[model samples]
Target: MQSTYNFWLVAISFAVATLASYTALDLTGRIFLLASARLRHAWRLGGAVALGVGIWSMHFIAMLAFSLPIPLGYDFATTACSLGLAIGASYLALVMTTRARLTALRLLSGGILMGFGIAGMHYTGMAAMDMTPGIHYQPGWFAISLAIAIGASSAALWMARALSNDDARNVFQKRSGAALVMGIAISGMHYAGMAAADFPLGAVCGAANGVNTIWLAAMVSLFTLAILIVTLMLSRFDARTTFLVGAVSKLNGQIIRLATLDSLTGLPNRATLTERVERAIQSSRRERSLFAILFMDLDGFKTINDSLGHSVGDDVLAAFSQRLLQCVRSSDTVARLGGDEFVVLAEHLASREDAGVLAESVLERMRHGIWSDSQPLQVMPSIGIALYPQDGDTVDTLLKHADAAMYEAKRAGRSTYRFFERSMNEAATRTLLIQSALHEALSAGSFTLHFQPKFHGGTDSLVGAEALIRLIDSKLGTLPPLEFIPIAERSGQIVQIGYWVVRETCRQIRRWIAEGLPAMKVAVNLSPRQLLQPNLVAEMLAIVQAEGVPCQQIMFEITETVAMQDAPKTIEMIREFQANGFEIAIDDFGTGYSSLAYLQRFRVKQLKIDRFFTNGLDEHGAEGSAIVSAIIALAHSLEMDVVAEGVETESQLDILKSMQCDEMQGFLLGKPLSANDFGDLLKHRTVAA
Candidate 1:
């Protein structure tokens, strides 16, 4: 006798199978994205229970739908065993589908394994009937049922992965269509297995005391449907929770960045620096080891800002921050304290020399510099290192000492690093005093120009004078250019001091002419910051014209370093100044690395030999006399006059005269004089020849 399926009960079984399949798809896809193994394992186990019950309930519901022609009830022990097989099959499906490195071989192999597991579950459920003659399966229908199981299992695996990848659109439609196909596959295989069943006409149910069939179908269907629904709802909640957690983490990271990083350079800010230094201090104290805090300030960064707008300066800063990050170790932390000042915490250092090594590396890299639109801008860093335990124990003290050392580095001419010294704090205090006095001196009109006259080396007649600014402060008392100029430059007062020098020189030239002194050219030195001023030439010309002084009567003196700093820019500005009939001279020549090609390009009126070379002239076959002779010859070849400055003795003057130096400016001829005294001397021609 053959068993038949009830169409209505069959529809219920198919519906249950469809829902279970859709839940399996949802469960596997969501579990794949979970980062926690424990959570995923919990979900996998829960999914297997829900999905396995659904599959088992659909099988039993369909079995209940079949008209057996004999009163039948399932064996209690076999029926329970069938449920175990179903749950095991569901677990196998979940595990196989969620592989990280899913490939064709794994997918094919997984499908076969899952297919066999499902068939085992179905066959075991058939055994739960336990008829008198036992339900025999026809070979042909059995083969067809197994084939359907395998093909459907493969199709389900492929569809689950594909739908997950293509989930951006038509989400409901895609899952629904897939669920329909899965329902048909499961129902067809079950019905095919049912068709294979050949129950004898005289068969009797063996398990008479087993569960009754009357309410079992309704109970299993409702129970399995509830489990699937609850599982799907929880899976949806978990997915939303995961998304919310990820979003919150991302927002928190951005907030942290805003609080701790410099907005302009993206380096750590001062707060972060303090925190890192504190951490390092704690760690070092525990380990009884050393670390270093490096405080760095960019040399001449103000001049760069004053010369080429702040925007370019910002670009340079950003680029160099990246370079500094690259140059340092991963254990080190770099921070921007604001406006050209930065700090680095070099942790786990073995010796103070290691800090020096890092500073040298930074200095070497900065020598090459970052290029902005073809202009190689130097980003020199004056770094000061303060060691842990040796320098100080607290963050504030270490930072202060490092800052004092950095000020000392700048005083020692920048482009270098210095370890913290106790004496530098006093020097730093003095620097602050001088800076304060500069402000008062500027307001009180205590700045005055002293004339240092230059004479013809051959005729000993005064040719011109260099106007040097002197500061007369009651508190600081008489300070020369060397005593305050560098400090003034660092404090950004050089530009104002520079303008004052130009205006005073023009006024003194007018006074001298009024006293009947010839309108000889008087040179005024221009600071690097002054030359970078956009309207420097125009402003100085206005001062001279207002004084009713001829442009030829004024000359501008720039250091060899300033002239060679940015060759093309300096040459262009020199030409602009010369166009207004003002002569340009390279002051302190041979003190800087000057390119001969660039020197020719400069085309200035004169070169003022630095006093360093002039001082060594008295020694026989001295390097100074040889260099001086070569310089004078080179100057004449280019039609440029060579002025030997800082002449103090007849021997030095005679050496310059022997080298045919065109002019001399030193104490040997005349000390720097007051404007009126210089005017009187020029008017009376009082110097002895």
Candidate 2:
């Protein structure tokens, strides 16, 4: 018997095949978009079941659509086996595609396997037919059918992958279009395989086969349509959920940035800086390398804020931060530690000099100055440097030491840099102690003045005395100038201490004059911190007047380092002091970088040689003697008097006397004495002469 197709049943079969194709593609698309691994696996398995059942149903329905001369019935066991093959094939395809990228190798392998599977299902279902003679397949048509299955399967998989890549855009439209194309391909493959089937003449169906063709076709169609509808609904829900999750993820990223970045400069804040430094430390420790931390404070930032207002100040800060960023490597971190203070963490340093080079670059860049609006701003950087495993090993210790070094840089005269040293930490501790003691000592009158007399080298007569400060604490005993003067300068207590020294020295001078002591100028050392004060000259004149001491009887001593810092300002202050009959002397003359021009510009009355040049005068071939001789010649040429310091040995005194040095003061002449003791010395010197 020859089979003939039923037109209406064939159309119904095509509709069922189309619906199954759309459902499978929709489910696969949804599975690809799922975020959770567990959910993706679950959905993939579920999709395999739906697709397998749908493909099986479409095939069976098409089988039911066939008409023949004899009745055909399917064997229940063989039919169920065909269904299993279809489901197994689908599961394998889903697993293969989901596990890895769909390379050409994977696509070809999956296509061949799925093609053989579909062919097996079709042939196995054909074998389910129980008739007088079993159904057979034409060799040529079978080949055509197999070709259709493999080609269609490969095309469908490639399309699915392509559509899923566009999931971020109009995904539903793309997937719907993909589903339409896949449906046509699957239905066409099914029809091609159906056309290969051949039944012999006079075939009769067996009673053991209980397949109902019409009812089975209707039931399969209804079941597939329901699955397709459910697949569509679930896909819509998944797409919406995915959009919300993506939005939430973006929001979380923004929150993270806000928490870690500075609002104005957009650089990392202190918290983020700390975290990055910790990470850098771990990396450096693992690699056995070094890193440096630089603490920077903007000089004259307060002046900018006061003069131009904070709005302009903020602009300057932002501009400066950008410049700073340009100076460092991308691997390094630059952070703002609030208001005019910034820090940099440089990692993976090959040597300590790398940090120095970077610091020099920063100084050079800032040397040109930063601009705010149209106005040019001049702000310098005072940087303190600390190295890992050398200065400190922890974040807090490193930052603390770096901060202390930064203050040291500022104290060394701003606009410079300093490295952390072990002694700096000790000095910092001592500074805190002295600061505490200084306040109490100042209040309790525990401070006393001592005078070291300066003598004329030729006459051996007293010419002047230098007033030195001493701090006497019940707990700490007496602290020398080295111990307390630096502490006072750093703590900003020098202004008060300097005023007290001037007042007491003047009062003592007046007392000596009343006791018939010959009048001699009393010299007081002025700290660099005091020289920067605007009222220093005025304060000294007022103290001299209040104590009834003539201005010519008092002299203010400033270090060469202090005077050379701002030459124009130093010259102006010196001229004002000289105009009022107060002598100005440069103490520690040879130790600093003061030029001969500055000495003449200030019209200084005297030059005091630093002790380092005088201490070694007794040694033969000592460079100290050569330096002392040169200084004496330089001072005399400028019409300025020379006083040699630290003259302990008679040999040093002999050298100075031969050099025609005007005066000498040290332990050899007389140690610094109490005011009463100095008065007695003066009286004895008068009697001796």
C-alpha TM-scores of all predictions: 0.74, 0.54
What's each prediction's clash count? 0, 4
lDDT of 1 by residue, 291-370 (tens): 99999988888887777789989988887788788778887899999999999999888888899999998888667745
Q: For residues 193-268, write the lDDT of model 2, one tens digit per residue.
A: 7777666666677724455767877887888777766766776677678878888998898788788988899999
How much is the lDDT of residue 619 in candidate 1? 56
The global C-alpha lDDT for each of the candidates, from Candidate 1 onward, is: 0.85, 0.81
How many angstroms is residue 587 displaced in model 1 relative to the true structure, after the best TM-score fit? Answer: 2.3
Off by over 4 Å in 2: 1-269, 278-291, 296-324, 338-341, 348-394, 404-425, 514-516, 619-626, 687-689
Clashing residue pairs in candidate 2 (N, C-alpha, C atoms within 3 angstroms):
1-200, 1-201, 1-202, 132-204
The alpha-carbon root-mean-square deviation between model 2 and the true structure, to one decimal in Å, is: 13.7
Q: Which candidate wins on TM-score?
A: 1
Error of 2 at 40 (Å): 35
